[model samples]
Target: MRERRTIIDAGWILLLLIWSVTILFPLIWVFYESLRTNQEFFQDVWKLPSELKWSNYRKAWEAYGIGRAMLNTVYYVGASLAIGTFLTAINAYVLTRLEFRGRKLVWGLIMLSLFLPGINALVPQYILMRDLHLTNSLTGLVILDSLSESAFYLMMLAGFIQSLPKELEESASIDGASIFQTFFRIIMPLSTAGIVTVAIFKFLGLYNSFLGPFIYLSDPKKYTIGVAMYQANMIMQYKTDWVTLFAGLVITMVPLVLMYIFLQRSIMEGATMGAVKG
Candidate 1:
C-alpha cells in the first residue's frame, strides 16, 4: 500500500510538471522571439538571436499604436470593472440576504441566463447601442459591459454572502443602521474576498475582450489592446514584421501576467471560501 501510494504521488507530480511546462513554454518563446530581428526570426525560427533587437518594442509601441491602445484598454477595463463589481455585489447581497416578492423568480431568471448562449444577444445589443447613438464610442462600450451581469460572479458572491452570519446584520439593524449602511459598511467589508475575486475576473474579461470592442468601436483611436493586437496581426500580413508583432503581443500579456502573479492567492482563497459553506 505504501509503495502504491508513493507511485501515485509521483505520477501526479509528473503530470503537474508537464502541465506547467506546456503553459510556460509559449510565454517564454514569445518573449525570446520578441527580442529577435525579423531576419533572424525568419531564418531560424527556433534559434536564439545573435544580438537582441530592443528597438522592436519601441517600433511596436510607436508604429503599431500599442501605447494608445493600452491607455484605451485601461479606461474601458477600469470603468467596466468598477461599475460591474459594485452592481454585482449589490445584486448578490440583495438576492442572498433580503426577502421580497418575486425574488425567487428573479433568481431563476438569472440562473436561466447562465445556460443561454451570449452570441444570441449580440444583435439586440448592437441595435440598442445604435439606437442610443453609443456605437463606436468608449462610453458605449463601458455601458454595454457594465450592464451585462455575470451569473458566475453573482452566484459566487451570493454563496459567500450566504455563508455570513445573520447576527451581524441583525445587530447593525438594532443599532439603527439602515439597510444601505449595513450593506456598505458591514457586509461589503466582510465580503471583500468575494468582491476582489469577482473584480479580478471582471478585469481579466474586459482586458481580453476582442469581439465587443471590434464590433462596437469603428474609430481606430478608440480601439482597445485586444483590437490593437488584431490590427497588428493584420499589418504583419503585409509587412512581415514578426518581431514587432511579437513585442506587441508581449506588451499585451504583461498586465494580465502581473495581475495573476500578485492576486492568485486571493483568487484561490475567495474561490474556496465561496464554495465551502461557513
Candidate 2:
C-alpha cells in the first residue's frame, strides 16, 4: 500500500509539473523577452538577454499611462467584485434557502443561459449602454458587469448553502434573529468558504475583463490594464518596441497572480465543497 501510494503521488507530481510547464513557459518567455532591447528582441527572439533591462517597466508605464489606467482598472474591478459577489451570495441564498412559488423556473431560466453564447448579447448590450449613457464611463462598466452574475458561481454557492444543516438557521430563528440578521450573522459567516471562492472568481473575472472595458471605455485614461496592454502592443506596429509590450503584459498579470496566491486556499475549499455537495 505504501509503495502504491508513493507511485500515485509521484505520478500526480509529474502531471502537475507538465501542466505548470505548459501554462508557465509562455509567461517565462515573455518576462525574459521584456529584458531584451528592441534590436535584440528582433534578432534573438529565443535567446537569453545579455542584460536585464529594469527600465523597460518605467518606459512602458509612462508610455502606457499605466498608472492612471491601473487606477481605473482598480475601480472597475473593485466595484464589480464587491457588487457582483454580494448579489450572487444573496441570489444563492434566496434560491437555496428561501421558498418561492417560481423558484425552480427562475433557476431554470438562469441555467438555460449557461449554454448561450455571451457574445450574442453584445450588440443589445452596446445599444442599451448607449441608450443609458453608460458608454465611455467606469460606472457604466461596473454596473453592466455587476448585473451579469455568473450562473456557475451562483450554483456553487447555492450548493454549499444546501449542504449545510438547516438546523443552524432554525436555531438562529429561535433566538429571534430576523432573516437579514440570521443571514449576516450565521449563514454568511459559515459560508465563508463559498463566498471567498466566488469573490476570488469575480475578482479574476473583473481584473482580466477585456470586452466590457474595450467596448465601453472610449477614453484612453479610463482604460483597464487589459486594454492598456492592447494599446501598448498596437504601438509595436509603428515603433517595434517589443520589450515595452512584454513589460506591460507582465504588469497586467501581476495582480491576478498575487490574488490567486493569497486566496488559493479558500478557492480550493469552495470549489471542492460545491463539487462534493452537488
Candidate 3:
C-alpha cells in the first residue's frame, strides 16, 4: 500500500510538471520572439535574437493604436464591472434570501439559459443593438454586457449567500433595518469574497472579449484590446512585422496576468465558500 501510494504521488507530480511546461513554454517563446526583428524571427524561429529590438513594442503601440483601444476597453470594463456586479449581487440576494411567487421558475429559466449557446442569440442581439444605435460605441457595449444576466456568477453568489448565518439577517431586522439596508450594509460587506471573485471573472471576460466588440464596433478608434490584437494580426499580412505583433500580444496579456496574480486567493476562497452550501 505504501509503495502504491508513493508511485501515485510520483505520477501526479510528473504530470503537473509536464502541464506547467506546456503552459509556460508558449508564453516564454512569445516574449522571446517579441524581442527579435521580423527578419531574425523568420530566419531562425527557434534561436534567440542576437540583439533585442525593444522598438518593436513602440512601433506596435503607435501603429495599432493600442493606447486608444486600451482606454476604450477600460471604459467598457469599468462600467460593466460596476453595473454588472451590483445587479448580479442584487439578483443573487433576492433569489437566495427573499420569498416571492415564481421565484423558482425564474431561477429555472436562468439556469436553462446557461445551457444554451450564446451564438444562437447573436443575430437577435445584433439587430437589437443596431436598432438602439449602440453598435459602434463603448456605452452600447457596456449596456449590452451589463444588462445580460450571468447564471454562473449568480449561482455562485447565491450559494455563498445561502451559507451565511440567518441570525445576522434576523438581528439586523430586529434592529429596525429595512431589507435594502440589511443587504447593502450587512450582507454586502460579509459577501466580499464572492463579490470580488465574480468581479474578477467579469472583468476578465469583458477585457478579453473579442466576438462582441468585433461584430459591434466598426471604427478603429473605438476598438478594444481584443479587436486591436486582431487588427495587428491582419496587419501582419501586409507588413510582415511579426515582432511588433508579438509585442502587442505581450502587452495585451500583462493586465490580466497581474490581476489574476493579485486576486488568486480571493477567487479560490469564493469558489470554496460557494461550494459549501451547494
Top candidate (lDDT): 1
**TM-score, prediction 2:** 0.93
Task: Compare the candidates by TM-score and give the number of the best one.
Answer: 1
* Clash count in backbone of candidate 1: 0
lDDT of each: 0.92, 0.88, 0.91
Lowest summed lDDT window (length 10), candidate 2: 269-278
Ranking of all candidate structures by their TM-score, best first: 1, 3, 2
Q: lDDT tens string, model 3, 1-278?
A: 99999999999999999999999999999999999988888898988788999999998899889899899999999999999999999999999999999999999999899999989999999999999899998899999999988898898888888888889999999999999999999889999888888898899889989999999999999999999999889877777888889998999999988988888888888777767765
For model 3, the stretches where C-alpha displacement exceeds 4 angstroms are: none
What tens-digit string does per-residue lDDT give for candidate 2 at 1-278?
A: 99999999999999999999999999999998988898888887987788889899999889888899899988998988889988998899999999989999999999999999999999999999999999999999999999987888988889888888999999988999998998888878988888898898788778878988999988997898889888877877788888988888888878888877887887888788778976
Report the C-alpha displacement of residue 159, candidate 2, in angstroms: 0.4
True-structure lDDT of candidate 2: 0.88
Residues 1-278, model 1: lDDT tens digits? 99999999999999999999999999999999999988988899899789998888998999879889989998999999999899999999999999999999999999999999999999999999999999999998999999899898899899999989999999999999999999999999999998998898889889989999999999999999999899888887679889889998998899999999999999999888877853
- The C-alpha stretches of model 2 lying farther than 4 A from their native spots are 1-12
| Ranking, lDDT, top scorer first | 1, 3, 2
RMSD to true structure for each model, in Å: 1.0, 1.9, 1.1
